[model samples]
Target: MEIERKLLKRSSLERLVDMMRSDGNMIYAPQKKETQVVFDTIETFADMTEDYIVSNQSPKFVAFPKIEKILDFSISQEGIRQEGTQLAAFPPVVVLGCRPCDADGFDSLTAIFNWDYKDELYNERLKRTTLISISCAQKDDYCFCTSVKGHPGSTRGSDILLTRFDGGDYLAEIVTEKGKALTEKYAALFEADPGIEKDKFLAEVKPRFEVEGLVQKCMGMFEHPVWIEQSLRCIGCGACAYVCPTCACFDIQDEAAVSKGERIRCWDSCGFGLFTIHTSGHNPREVQSQRWRQRVLHKFSYMPERLGVIGCVGCGRCSRACPVDMNLSEHLINIAEV
Candidate 1:
């Protein structure tokens, strides 16, 4: 499936936006405001900005949503009426400029949504959208995808992949059938070029982990002291779950306004003190240490032991969103020993 093709230069990102528009697809990217890049729909060429580390929030919400209105219930003189609502229409969507770590999180998350309960809403939206994953040569201290099982120039859940070239050009690689078709449609925008530097390009992108023993090593430690030491500063505010790319716990409640009441499911977090509280005024994981233990166990041990795949994407959103600066990678590295 390897093919040599001319890539889009840094200057031609505007042209890519035009390609998205002409094909009747809705494009969502890291749009530039005044100083920062936020996820939104672009109007002109000025909105496309992929230079930021990661957004304040993960792009998962753009597809799954934080809190969604599934249906409406009304009680009138005629007794009661229930009005149902399905997930939105399957609009052709392009989640442009998502990184390799950004895209891999979705593949790890897709399992939970499709396991015992088939969430058609999440799956349908995913089916329609195209993820353009990337590999960043520029990384900081906290960007540690290599530790577990991730790489900078990796193709995880990307339909299309892009790598930064030496002279402002991108090495565009198609990872899926959808990406191949999309590229074929925009064939005029690309040139068929023979790549002479394939080995050099592959050498530039190397995975950092000896992934064979990671899961087994992570599975053997349950009562390890690192959980207490690592999570000592945590306050259990649930902010990590709020900003996570793969944390999928939710709570459903009935909202009664006037005459109409709707049953809604909103995102919930295991990190919150109230998350494990019983109706009899008893709480299990009232302490932050216990909550943090659950976080690691769920990602490394419980999830892998049960679901066959780990629960984290190494996106560092949890670490980024922590008020006390509780870094996940720093903590996980300590646990990697056991």
Candidate 2:
């Protein structure tokens, strides 16, 4: 619980990256891919994108991949053999330049995975990864972290947090024991903080809505026309859930050869028509409008009631990725007003 502050020079970041890699850690940083910025496995600091507000994808994939192997199986002459998931095999990771919203979203993911049954794979990766989140200096209109009780410089799930200073240096907040270990191990890279504050350069995001009773309001709106109006243009591509920081729906499948096979879990979306189809061929959420209502209610109502945490972190990637421009903030604000 000891909060340590330090100063990091811009030039020293490359050295830090080198230090982490030399320590047998995998580095995940934001990289430029055409017009989008993505968090990718990086070997050097030069591979990352600078001055980007948010990544096209969340760092959630670092721990919970879009597709992951759950079990490997083989059939023999006598019987069947299966190899289960191994916790010791997960590698140590250092996530650099993670935004505050994405870091906070990790808490929601952790809550879900560890809720009823402990997911050893995800927990192992979570334990092994150290987040070095950078405060947002720039944001677009789509960004609304404040609406979800998050801030640009908040340290919810990050181990270490970095904020840009006036002189191109970074003000580092060692938020956790892991972060403290990292700074102490690489003590040469960070200098004692000279009382410089982080607020000067932090991006200011206004709250989009009064979220107090919105979840309750959503229940009343199950039959409301807003769902139809809002989701009419939805193409059901599931792009929003894919880019979301806290969407955790997934489908398990067994991919098999003649004698060998693997059980894998892949990302799924409630936005899709097939998400809740019964085995008897009855779909509760048969239409796009009902499916849209499920997304809103689950995030705002069910998650909060069940997990004691709001699901959305308000990174705004869903709005950015949606082809129909289904702005979540606008829709939520409308719901709040209703």
Candidate 3:
């Protein structure tokens, strides 16, 4: 679809931030923290690094945190009673300078959270946030976003997309109603640039993503020896699952000092041997290879087959976060080519 395009000069950085901040929105962007690029609240557009590389942690942390507190309860003498439970409203948020993969991952996440359970907390958080994807001018060797129907510079689930053209000006495309509302609110910061058409800038986007029957092919190799041989040296740790953009498995626990406590949710991983251990120590998936196979299957086949779309965003964080060097991209490409 041809979207309405606008122009924002390099000087408009402060203006954009001011506009968003005026509405009590939290603006988060990639900030330089020593050697790594981390996402944090940015008070100004100067904090936005246009040439910033991939963030050490995918922006998923902003949506579903590693650990979260859900509800709290209190008990005295009479009976159990509900205590302070209502959370503060999530003010408007703008995730600025997000990549296409990060944006798509969040969109895919909405499905499961809103499935049968209907998580109102997560839904509320999402409604209050706006995703603004900034086009990537470069692609590293480890990037495989294109393989899963994603691209380095493409915009899929963003409310607004910014494409940097020649000179210091950017071509902006309003992708969703949130983007329109934001643009309308900050109309003075923008000017219609006729030098470039919407498609022209998008034409230059090159993501080496190859989405064939890669996931399905991985499905075919569920019990194959490759898993056993490749994963034999792997230690049963949850680092891979912990760093993956699409890994949503979690365990909820309640903590109570006396008769009442708070309900908490935290991340979980299949790599842990105790993940499937029954009360009687009956572990169906006892080996690391079996655990690893489950990871591949859940990401490649199970999620897509059930959700009608790809599960993984191909962020490469799993490979980067692996302790034993269990690179996911190599395994995926190996199965995909076969």
Candidate 4:
């Protein structure tokens, strides 16, 4: 379907937030948390911070939580009973003010969750969630969204994409049916199209390296020495994976008591030393170099071959969050040159 264009004022945006809240939708927006900006549930539009280039954390947590209880089980003399988390009870959610790269990361996650088996929990949460992304008017050195086929104002995964003009008004592009419905519901808040050019208002993110070339180089460099050289300073803190939007590695654990137990799924990272440890005390990726290889290959080589989508959106949160200054874009550029 063709996208519908409209104009939305800053005042109208505030009212729209209120209207969504009144309709029982949970709104997650960027808020100033101490020294960094993060996405947190907001009661009103005023809670959102407009001064940040990007949120410290991606809004993926709204659908894929860091820690989630999948099921609970009780033991008895006769038998054992288990109950799974109810997906139908999930609340409708709106993730507002996300960057286009952040929104595009969801595609990688969706491919992983539904690769061979369907994940009802993830699917349900995603179905109920609507993405309202705000275009980036400025960027920092760490941003490389364009290198991964993403733009500062790309509407790949957004329901509604809002680009702010110089005058504080927004050029709203209703990209999906979900966005159309939202606009229709709050028709009064939106005005006719002002025919604004969104490109001029968006941040200019130049491509660092060709993603296809990077993928090809990664596919044949499993045993290359570059992994060891690039990861020499890594401390295996897993900060990169945790802050990344597309790294979906996880660990499942069973918490048990005398009569009951719960199964939980928590975020894990390939960078962690214990991620590949076996009960026999053997680890496939015992060294940081091997782990680093896994991370790069998973994103650039393996995922694209299997899932038909790259496992990175070049959001650069990983680079910014790395304690040892491991810049992913620079590393990939080097590999592409190799």
Candidate 5:
């Protein structure tokens, strides 16, 4: 479909949020949480914070939650019974004010969940969700979305992309059917297109390194000493994977008392020491350096070869969240130069 551009005044945005909530859609927006800006459930437009470059965490949890129940089982005297999660029960969600990089992370998650096995639960939640992203007008040193084929104004995964003009109004680009439906529903809120250039209002994020070249360099660096040198201070806390938008490793466990239990899927990380532990008490990645190498190689090499998608979205949340001050973009640049 041809993209439709429109102008949305500041007041219209507040009204749109009200309309969406009245229409039974759960609205997720970035709000100030003490010192951090994070995505949380909002009751009104006033609940959102306008001064953040990016949320401390991505909105990935809306679909692929940090912890989720997949199945329930019960053992009776007669036989064992099992019940699966109802995918259809997932609620309609609108992620408002996410950055373009945060929106783009969904593609990586989709590729992983759909490869070799289809996760209907995840697909169902994603289908019911709509993304309303705002273009970034400012960035910090940690941001590197441009290095990974993304832009501040890119509309790759957003249903609606809104770029804020100098006057505080938004240049709303309806990029998908879901976005068009939203505007159509609230036609009164959206005005005619004002013909403003979106790029002029977006942040200038310089590309740190060519992704293709970085990928090629990573393929030959498996035995390189860079991994050990860079991972010397890593404490194996898995903070990077937790804050990352595209890391999809998970572990499944069952919680029960005696006869009844529920199977849960929780987030996991390649940075952890026990992530690749074997049943024979052997670990393929015995040291922190090997585990750190797995983290980089999986994102830059393995996922691209197998799933045709890069597992990292260059959101920079991992770098900011790292307690040891391990900057991922700097590490990638050094790797490329090496």
Candidate 6:
């Protein structure tokens, strides 16, 4: 699709932020929290932090929260009652400053949520949200979006993409109907595209490895020792999954006092030993090695085959957050070579 392009001055960008909030849209952007940069709710443009290469966590939490109430149940003398979150009650939101990897990961998450069963809450939230991604200007050893067919300026799951110019200006690539509508509504804030080149300012990320035939290679390595040797240092911490943008595994729990309770849905990780445990005291992924295998296979093999989309977005947050310095790129390269 041909995207609409526009030029926005640094000061005008702040006006856009004000306009979205004045129109009653919830804005989520990067903010400086202590030492780390994180995606958080912002009240004004002044609250936005512009010094981060990437956020501590992905913007997925805006649509798929870490903790969500699935339904509330009540018991009375007459009968039992249950109520669920209403789709109509959801508020509109805008995710700003999302990286390309983070925004593109939404496609993988959407496929999983709308797969066999439609998750009403996730779908509802997605329908009401607009993603505005910023082209990456900085990348590190941990970043490798190119290997996954993604780029620093990708617009896969973004409504709009903003690329910085030399003079504190931004080039806006309106990629979707939602983006066009927002620009049309706030026409005064945007200027006609002056045909300025955007590639000069965008980050250049080298591909880590080729994904072609990688999934097929993984199929034969199910019982390979690489899985065990590579994952031996894993501490069973769910930090990698938590920081991942496409990981959608979750667990449901019933919280009760006696008569009143709520069924809650919380994030889960395949790296955890008990994630696939059965009630009969048997676990499918009994060791860290097996659990690690599931994580890699699901991202590189299962999701791509089933949904036609790669689950990993190459954000590198997992590698950054890993306590044992488990580099994802290294593991994948090893597997591909084997």
**Higher-ranked by TM-score: 1 or 2:** 2
Name the TM-score of candidate 5: 0.98
Pick by lDDT: 4 or 6, better one: 4
| lDDT score for residue 154 of model 3 | 63
Candidate 5 per-residue lDDT, tens place, 1-338, comes to 78899999999999999989999999999999999999999999999998999899889998899998999999999899999999988889999999999999999999998988999888999999999999999999999999998999999889999999979999999999999998999999999998998889999999998999998888889999999999999999999998888988999999998999999999999888889999999999999999999999999999888988888888899999999999999999999987
lDDT of each: 0.73, 0.90, 0.76, 0.92, 0.93, 0.91
TM-scores for all predictions: 0.88, 0.97, 0.90, 0.98, 0.98, 0.98
List the candidate 5 regions with Cα displacement exceeding 4 Å: none
lDDT of 5: 0.93
Residue pairs clashing in model 5 are none
lDDT of 2 at 64: 92
Kindly give the stretch of ten consecutive residues in candidate 4 with the minimal lDDT sum.
Answer: 210-219
**Model 3 error, position 155 (Å):** 1.6
**Candidate 2 structure quality by residue, lDDT tens digits, 65-114:** 89889999999897899998787998899999999999999999998999
Relative to the true structure, candidate 2 reaches a TM of: 0.97
lDDT of predicted model 1: 0.73
Task: Judge candidate 4 against the unseen true structure and give its global Cα lDDT, from 0 to 1.
Answer: 0.92
lDDT for each residue of candidate 6 in 164-226, tens digit (9 for 90 to 100): 888878999999998888889999998999588888888899997888678778767788999
**Rank order by lDDT, top first?**
5, 4, 6, 2, 3, 1
| Residue 160 lDDT (model 2) | 95
Best candidate (score: lDDT): 5
Show where candidate 3 strays beyond 4 Å. 83-88, 197-210, 258-260
Segments of candidate 2 deviating more than 4 angstroms = none
